[model samples]
Target: MIGFTLLIALVGAERIAELTVARRNRSWALSRGGVEYGRGHYPGIAAAHAGLLGGALLEAWLLDRPFIPALGWPMLGLAVLAQGLRWWCIATLGRRWNTRVIIVPDLPLVARGPYRRLRHPNYVAVVAEGIALPLVHTCWITALLFTIVNLGLLRTRIRIENTALRQAADTTPASP
Candidate 1:
């Protein structure tokens, strides 16, 4: 339980850092005429994430869940890996990365780092953390609930992002 609490605290701190980076990036992008899409779903997405964290803690405590050594160890490792991937995405995207779906017009798509291999590597990290974090403390219910809700949210998010990306690509002039 102590370990789980510490883990959650660390995750919370990591989220704060990500938000700091995201806010800076968002400001930089908006200053350069970046347009945001899918604002309608943003609130729900935010709620789901907040719920995941709170629900995990609540469920673990209320259910009196004990950390299963086998599952907990592997989930902890997976959570660490997810954080690494999340940072990699942020580093690769630089000022283009944000919590919201904001795209700067005429900028070519980033194709380096994890982006070279996967179109939505950041979401992969989100999914991984969503699952791994709760499971680390034997909070399977929280893990399953967040995964389902997040998937629904991602469906709309991806569609909006793809359309935005395509529109940006169309508007960008072909290089000589």
Candidate 2:
């Protein structure tokens, strides 16, 4: 349980790091005329993520969720892999990477890194981590609820981002 708690704390720290990066990137993007989309859902996204970490701790401690070695080890690996993928997406996007959909016109969609194969690799990391993190300590309830909430959030999020991308592309003038 002590180890699991530390793991969650580490994940929380990682989330803080991501938000700090996102804040800096958001400012950079906006300064260069980046238009943000889907601001409304950002709060829900933050809440759901916070809930994931908190719920896992509460459920594991209060409900006495035991760590099954077979499940825990594999889930831990997946969580770590998800973290790697998340960072890859961040590095690939660089200053353009943000928690909110902020598109700079005339900039073509990223084609390198994980973006080459996955349209939304960051979300892939989010989904994978959400599941694997909770399941690490057998917090099945948190895993289930968080997954359900994220699916709804992602559906809206994806639609807004695609529309924003299309609009930005249309607004950008074609090269001579």
The prediction achieving the highest lDDT against the true structure is: 2
Candidate 1 differs from the real structure by a C-alpha RMSD in angstroms, to one decimal, of 0.7
Candidate 2 local lDDT, 1-33, one digit each (tens): 999999999999999999999999999998888
What is the C-alpha lDDT profile of model 1 across 128-152, one tens digit per residue? 9999999998999999999999999
Model 1 TM-score, 2 decimals: 0.98
Clashing residue pairs in candidate 1 (N, C-alpha, C atoms within 3 angstroms): none
Error of 2 at 3 (Å): 0.7
Model 2 per-residue lDDT at 72: 94
Name the weakest run of 10 consecutive residues (lDDT summed) in model 1.
2-11
Write down the TM-score of every candidate: 0.98, 0.98
lDDT of 1 at 150: 99
